[model samples]
Every structure is written in structure tokens, then in C-alpha cells.
Target chain A: MKAIGSFKGEPITDSDSLVDVEVPTPDLAEHDVLVEVKAVSVNPVDTKLRAGAPSQKEPLILGFDAVGIVVKTGSNTTKFSKGDRVWYSGTTKRPGSNEAYQAVDERLVAKAPRSLTDEAAAAMPLTSITAYELLFEKMGANFGQLANPGKTLLIVNGAGGVGSVLSQLAKWAGFTVIATASPANFDWLRANGVDQPIDYHDDLETQVQGLGHHFVDAAVILYDVPSYYDAVTKLVAPGGHIGAIVGTQAKLNMEQLKSKSLSLDWEYMFAKGDFDFRMETQGEALRQIAQLVDNNFVHTTLSRTIDSGLNAKNLREAHQVVEEGHVVGKVVVSGPFNGQVNE
Target chain B: MKAIGSFKGEPITDSDSLVDVEVPTPDLAEHDVLVEVKAVSVNPVDTKLRAGAPSQKEPLILGFDAVGIVVKTGSNTTKFSKGDRVWYSGTTKRPGSNEAYQAVDERLVAKAPRSLTDEAAAAMPLTSITAYELLFEKMGANFGQLANPGKTLLIVNGAGGVGSVLSQLAKWAGFTVIATASPANFDWLRANGVDQPIDYHDDLETQVQGLGHHFVDAAVILYDVPSYYDAVTKLVAPGGHIGAIVGTQAKLNMEQLKSKSLSLDWEYMFAKGDFDFRMETQGEALRQIAQLVDNNFVHTTLSRTIDSGLNAKNLREAHQVVEEGHVVGKVVVSGPFNGQVNE
Candidate 1:
């Protein structure tokens, strides 16, 4: 099987940063399915892991979101069968989808949306799972046939990947969505169901308040956590939830949240995979997301496509596009395994 | 009406740290009940609010937990009638519960336990509300007749006011309770239904691990938050809840929580009262706590009582006992308002 990997932590511009190599096709565990990855999407985690030296003896395969077909299944696998189309953001601890074939726990893999292309399906899994988990699970937002829609949600970076999906979900749940972006992406934010789009370059707190929201029911910080932690605490109502997808080693003045008795929710989409805890829920969440997509309630967030297919060059270009930090939605690379392979 | 108050942020040793002052009896708002406070309990919030200089022109009266008799009820108040025995931890925004007569919202007052003394009833509210909110509400702990008993809860500072009540509630919910206290209070922890007691002086992580728990399902820090935040983070399982009631001005390494997708829940019992958001819930929680007490599922945490009554001297004694720390359970000052009165 051909896989593009970073042998060492290096800039994307370095030719050796991502190189094609041959590796044995992954063996299936009892609950595993061997998937032939058909398409892949580049995310911030992909860039982050790419910039770090791999802990494994093998080179780091940098990918998360993928639409693939089940090639084989382990003896105990029950959720998926061979030839079934699937989409998943596989475990961060294991080899990723930037490969011709990969073994993934069947519980974490869900059927790909029939209405979307492989590239589009690949773009939705990681960000969709992240947004869903943070909004419903971590933040404990309530939604039913008749949930109160008077509640408001603030997304710090609404034009980004997770933000784009989360805003749509929040809108579907009938929440008032206030999101942040530069003036240039205001239209994009509005199109994605953002009720109010505040300029990122301007004062976020002032702008949010200027829009007449004294405090949001919850605020999900999809970007720099430390920079937004204080403001989010202030913007959230007493006893509200504040969700963060970003990590920072720098200390935070968490006491600001104390007076309001707020909750800080950290959403690392791969936590279930890393701990081997509740992996089936990811598949279930993706199934729900797929249903929403097929129903036209939610649309795929794929904004850029590298039809040149999944080679080292296309993978590198996808990483570079995400690294530039202003990509509107998601950048996906379709697959034909044009990357190098050992004879 | 006579009250014991702190006009300045002064040491307990200072003669004027707590002084007898005459203040006007408060009038009732639409939802208010005028209560003649019979007994009061000292809590950390009482001490904390006492330490701070009041923003209002009046001296700060620092009582929170009180058992009283409704002397009058406002036109809109329906929950209480004159002569009704009630228990409450009223809002910090108001004058608090340190006077001969205090006007409080009916929604923040619940019927006092018939089986307990005024002092005993008074000792339960502030801590019980804190514990209930932290355990059930903030942590989102599931509790029912047949809730999964497999979950484990860690209570840091297990012999303190909130810890004493919280441990019992956790036990009732069938949780395996792990609590921290001085070696001297091991018996108290056991008596309070803690399955495992770890010494606070020892290495908490090593001790917790030695007891065969890689992680606890939830941990509530009843004491210093900054000092325990790191260890609590390490001790909580992936996607578990870490609850805190103490506020700290110092910054915390909140990033460590990102990997496990953990949640930090801050439970300030006064949040509802302070914000006027859902004051009715506090009364309902107290009613539940009362039922638990009557059913013998819980007990008053009061250990010592200042039968000398709620005067400047006795109030100072209770404050001193609390400020000294390490006392098991809670301390209370029975009240008949024997302080100086304006003629």
C-alpha cells in the first residue's frame, strides 16, 4: 500500500516534508474494518501532527477525514461489510487516511452520505463530529421537537471548518447564532446561517454586545482559546457553557468564569479513539450527520478540491492551503494513490 | 434590627472585625418573605464575603445559611405563610441572613426540617445547595433508583461543609466515593459513606492510583482550586467531569484538560441567586435535601454550635472557628439577634 508520510518534522515547503512510501496493508483487529481510502481532507490537526515528529518507528501519516470503501472486515466486525462506502475521522493514535488502505475500528466508521461525492463526504466527518460532540454532548445543549430557541450561541470562528458545521447545527436546533469572522467572510458566515457576523479584527466583546446580546447561552471557541477565554467568559450568561476545541500550554485566568459558575468544555474529537472509549458514538453521530446532509438540512462544507488526487504533491498542497489559516471551509484531496510506492 | 457586621476588611483579632450595628428591618418585594432568623451557619462564602469591603454604603453582614420563621409575606409570595419555619441561603447580592429580620424571596426559601434544631437546619442549606448543584447539576451526574452504581466520584476536602453532605448524596446515588481529608478525619469520611479516604497531605494521584482507580468519573474540588486543578485533571477519566466551587485569582493550566475532552464545572451556589436566573431551583433543592434528611438518607453537618446566640461575640467565635480551618463538618451560631439595637 502507498502512504504519504512526514519522516521528520519539517516545513511543508521542504520537499521531504511529505514523501510517498510503501507500507504493509494494516491488519484488522476483532472490531476493525480494512478501508480503501478514496478521498481525504486536511485539517488543523493534520497540520499540527505533520509539524511534530512522529512517535512511531514508522513515518507519521497525516490525515483524519476520509471517505473510503470497506475492503475487508475483522471476524467480529458487525457494523460494516466489505465494499460498503464509509466516512470517518479515524484514531489519532493510529496510522491515518493519507494512505491507499487503512484499518479502522468499525464502531468509528459510518456509512458515507449517498447524496454527496467522496470528496464532500470526506470533508464532513471530522468537523461534523467535532461540532456535534461539542454542541450537544460537551455543552449539553438541549434540542427536541420544541426546544426553546430564544437561547443564543456564539461561535468564535464561524467561517472555519468546525465553525461552519457547528453554526449550521446550531441553526437547525433553532438557536440564535452569533459568529465571528473578518469583513471579507461576512457573506460566507451569513450564508452558513450565522445571524450576526462580528469582524475578527474588531473588538469581539464590543461588537457582540453592540448586537444586543447581553450574554450568550453558550460560546464555542473554535480558534485561539487563550485569546478568547476571558471574553467568552464575560459573554456567556451565568451558569452557561463555554466550549473550546483549541489547546494552549499558556495558563488561563479561569477564575473569570467562577463568578458566573460557567463550565469549560474541551472537545478533542479523537478522545474516544485515543482512550478506546465509546467509539460507536462517533459512527452514530456521523450517521445522523449523513441523514441531515441527505435531507438537505445540512450541506457538505467542502470548499476546495484537489482533483489532481491523493499524491504527495496534492497532500502537500492541501496542507499548505490549511496552513495559510484563512481557508473558507475544507480542502479535500481525492484519491487514486498517485504517491510513490516501494517496488 | 441588630446585626453583626464587618465595616472594614480587618483581622478576626481586631475588636472591630465584627461589630454590633443597628440597621433598618428590610421591607418585602413582591416575591419576598420577611423572616425572623432563628439560627445561622458559617460557610466559606460567609468568610469570603466578610473579607471583602462591601460595595454598598452599609457594612457587610456575612451570614448565608439560616433557619427562620416567616414574620411576613409579600403579596406575590405564595410558598410561605406567617410563622412558617423555613431554611435558606439567600443571595449574596442582598444583606444576607445575619439580622433580627430579613426579607428574602419565597423561591429561595424552603420548609426547614421538623426533626432538627434551628442550628442544625441552618447548617445544611449553603453547603447542601453547593453540594447538590456541584454534584447533580454542574457535573450532570445521573441519579435514580437504578442509576449505574459503577461510577466513581472523588471529593477533594471530604470532611468540609460541602463535602460532608455531597459524600452522602453520592453514596445514595450508588457511586463509589473517594474523598480526601487529614488522616484524623478518615473515620469521618467513612461515616459520611466515602468508600475510600485519601490523606490530603499525601500525593493525591499516587494514592488514588494505589487504590486501583486510573481515573474517577467525577471530582469536585471543595477547597483550593488552583492547587488541585492539575491533580484533579489527571485523576478524572477521559470525557469526565471535574467540578469546582472555590474561585482563584491565579491562572490555571487549563490546556491539560483538552486531551481527554474533560469538562471543568464551576458550581457557585449563589449563581442563581446572584443572577436572579432560577431562584426557584434552590428552594426545590432544599426541599429535596429536607426529604433526604427526614428519610435519614442525609444528616445535618453541624458539629459545634454557638448556643451563645448570634451576637457580635458569638458570630466572631464562629468566624474564628471556621478561619482556623481543619474542623470537621460545619459550625453554627444559634440566633435570637442579641446584638446592639438602635433605640
Candidate 2:
């Protein structure tokens, strides 16, 4: 099977950053599904791993978000069959979906949205799973029931992929969404169901206060850890919830949250996948997410798509595009050598 | 009205640290109650105020936990009548309850427990208010519902005034309580209803893990911030909640909470009184707590009581006891006289 992997940290611009190699496939367990990868999206985790993959005996496969078809199913796998379209964010500790044929636990895979294209569906899994878990699972949003109708959620860095989807989902769950985006994306954010889109460049505390809301019921941070920590802390109401997706190096004086009795939480969506806990819930969440997309309640964040066959050159270019840091949504490498997009 | 106050920060050993001074009677508002203070408990807050009290135009009166009788009630006050026995933790911004007569908002006052003596009642208000809010209000422990029966709560520093009361309340609320205390206080901690009293002198994580509670549902921390932060991060269950009453000058790396999706909260119970939020709830909680005490579901932690007359010398001695930090539970100063423990 053809795979894209790295042995050690390297700059994305270097030729050896991500290499195309052949790796032998392993025997499948009773709960595994072998997927023939058709399309995959590059996320920040891809770049992070590319630059930080540990030096080990085996090469580290790099992609997490992929849309593919079940080519083989284990005897115990009942949810999927051969030729079933699926989308998933695979586990971090195992071989990722960068390979042409990747064997994964059936529990992590979900039926892809039939109404959307493979590229669009590929972009949804990792970010959507993270946003969904952070809002509904960890923060106790309760998607099965209507969230507080007038409750406000402040989404920091609202134009990013996860924040974009989270805004729509929070709105879908009945919350009045307040998102922070750049000046250029204000109209785009409001168009995508955000009730109010504030400029991330301004003083967020002042802006939130000026909105006549003394504090937001909850806040989700998608980017800008050090700069936005205080702003989020100041904006949350008494006993309000705050979840940060990214990791930080410094200790953040949690005492800041004491006055309001604010709850500080961290959401790393891959933990359950890595630790093997209720892994089937990921598939269930993805299935529900697909329905939401099909019903037009949520939209994909595919900014652009390229076709160059699943190889090293195509992967490097995709990494370069994402590394530029101004992606409107997502960039996907798809197709079996489509002539123009590849050229 | 005669009161103990200080115009500036000074050592408790200094004769002028807390002086008896006569000030004009406070004017009563529509919902205010004029109480003749009968007894007062000296908490860390009193010492804190004596050292950190703001230099104001008028002298800053000190003391928070107080038990008294309502001498007068203003118009629109319906909760209590003249001669009603009450206890309260005074508002942070207002003149405190350590005086011959103190005017307090009726919402901050609750009927004292009929079964408790004045000293015992005074020892409860501040600690009870803090513990109740930390458990029910901050961490959302449902005292009204037995939803998470047999759930574990790790209370750090459980032999202190607030911890002693909190351990019993957690037990009453159907949680299996694990408390951390010094070796000397182990039996006392167990006697206070803690199922397990681990020594906080060693690694708290290992000690708790040895007891078979690898992770806890919630935690209430009273002291030792730097040592406990890492242990709390490790011992808190995934999606568990932690609340603390201590202040920290050092920054905390909140990313530690990301993997398990833990919640880190700080419970400043005075916030409600300081910010004037749901003030009536404090009185209501105190009233319910009084009932719990009357029913013997809880007990006061008045370790030592001084019939110290309302004067500078006696108040200074009470402050000294709290400052020494060896006193268990509460040290209260009571009665009225010409600057002596006995009238």
C-alpha cells in the first residue's frame, strides 16, 4: 500500500518533509475495517505532526481526516460493508488514513454524507468531531434536546474551520451564537448563522460588554491562546463554561476565573479515539453530523480542492497551502490524477 | 456604635492593630436590618482584611462570620423581625459584622440554628456559605437530587474550618468523600464523616490512587496551591469538576485539563455578596444549613471560644490565633466588656 509518512521533524518546504513509501498491510482484527482512501483533508494536526513526528522504528503515518470506502470488513463489523462510503478522524497513536488502504477499527468510522462530495465530507470529520464533542459532550450542550434558546456562546476565531462549524451547530442547537472573525469574514460569518460577529482585532471584553450581555454563557476558543485567554475569562458569566481546543505552554493563572466561578475546560477530541472509550460514539456522532449536512443545517468548510493522486508531491503542496495560515476553510487532495487540478 | 477597626495594615502583635472606635450608626436602607452583634468568629478573612484592607476615608471595620439579634428592620424587609436570631457572612465591600450594632442587607442574613449556641452559630456562616456555594453553586453538586450516589469527591485540606463542614455536606449529599489531612488530624477527619483520610504530606495522587480512587468526580481545595495543582489535574476524572477557595499568584497551565476535559473552577463565595447577585440565595442557603445543623446532619467547628469582650486587645488575640495557622476549625471571640475575655 502507498502511504505518506515521516521519520523525523522537518520543515514542510524541505523535499524530505513527507515521503511516499510502500508499507506492508497488517492482518485485520474482528472489529477492523480496511478502507481504500479516496480523499483526505489536511488539518493543523497534520502540519504539527509533520514537524514533530518522533524518531522511532516505524514511520509515522500523518493524515487523520479522510473520506474513503470500506473495501473489507471484519466478521464482527455489522455497521459497514464493502463499498460503503465512510468518513472519519482516525486514532492519533496508530497508522493514520494517509495510506491508500488503511485498516481501522469499525467503531471510529461513520457513513459519509451522501449529498456532499468526497472532498467536502473529508474536511468535516476531524474538525466537526472536535467541535461537536467540545460543545455537546464536554460542555454538556445536550444536542438531543434544545439548548437554551437565548443563551450566548462566544466563539473565538470564528472563521477557522472548527469555529465555523461550531457556530452553525450552536445555532442549530438553539443558542444565540456570537462569533469573532476578521473584518473580511464578518458578512460571511453572519451569512452562516452567527447572530453577531465581532472583530477579533478589537477588545473582546469591551465588545461583549457593549452587546448588553454582562457575560456570555459559554466560550469556545479555536485559536490565539495567550492573547485570547484573558478576554475569554473576562467575558464568561458567573458559572459559565470555557473550553479551549489548543494546548498552551505556559501556566494560565486560573485564579482569573475565581471571581465569576467560571469553569475552565480543555477539549482534545482525539483522546477518546486514542484511549478506546465509547469509540462507537464517534461513528454515531458522524452519522448524525452527516444527517445535519444533508438536511442543510450544517455546511462543509472546503475552501479549495486539488487532485494529484495520493502521493508525496501532492501532500507537500497541500501542506504548503495549509501552512500559509489564511485558509478560508479547508484544502483537500483528491481524485486519481484529475488532469487540470493536478496540473 | 463601638467597633474594632484599623486605618492601616499592622502586625497583630501591635497594640494599635485593631482599635475600638466609636463611629456614627449606619443609616438603614429599605431592606436593611440593624443587628446587635452577640458573637463573631475570626477567620482568615479577618486577618486578610486587617492586613490588606483598603485605606479609606473612614476606618475599615473587620470581621465576617457573625451571629446577632435583629434590633430593627427597615421598610420592605419581610424575612425577619425585631429580636430574631440570625447569622451571616457580611458583604465584602460593606462595614463588617464586628461591632456593637451592624446594619446589613436582610438578604445576607439567615435565621440561626435553634439548636446551636451563639459561638457555634457564628463559626458557621462564612465557612458554610463558602462550602455550600462551592459544592452546589460552583461545582453544581445537586443536594436536592441523589443523581450521582456513591460518587467520590476529594477534598484537599479537610481538617480546616471550611473543609470540616464541606466533608460532612458532601457525605450528606450522597457522595463518598475522601479527605486529605495531616497525620495528627486523621482521626478527626474520619470522625467528621470522611470515608478515607489520606495524608497530604506525600504525593496526593499516589495516595488517592492507592486507595483505589484513580480519579474523582470533584474536588474542593482549601490550601497549598502549587503542590496540589498537578495532583488535581491527574486525579480528576475525565469531565470531572474541581473548585478551590485559595488565591494563587503563579500562573497555571490550563492545557493540563484538555485531555480529560476537566473543569477548573475557583469558588469565591463572597462574589455573590460582593457583586450583589442573588443575595437572597445566601440567606436561603444559610436557613437550610441551619435546619441541617438543627437536625444534626452537620456540626459546627468551633474548636476554641473566647468570651473576648468587643475590644481591640481581644480582637487582636483572635487575629493572632488565626495567623498562627495551627488552630483547628474556628476560633471565635464573643461577649461584651471593657477589653477582656470575661465581662
Give the best candidate by lDDT. Answer: 1
Clashing pairs in 2: A251-B252, A251-B253, A252-B252
Q: Fnat of candidate 2, please?
A: 0.61
Best candidate per TM-score, number?
Answer: 1
Clashes of 1: 0
Q: Estimate each model's TM-score.
A: 0.94, 0.89
Question: lDDT per prediction?
Answer: 0.87, 0.83
Query: Which pairs clash (backbone N, Cα, C closer than 3 Å) in model 1?
Result: none
DockQ of structure 1: 0.70
Query: Candidate 2, DockQ to 2 decimals?
Result: 0.46
At residue A250, give the lDDT of candidate 2. 70
TM-score of 2: 0.89
lDDT of model 1 at position A64: 92
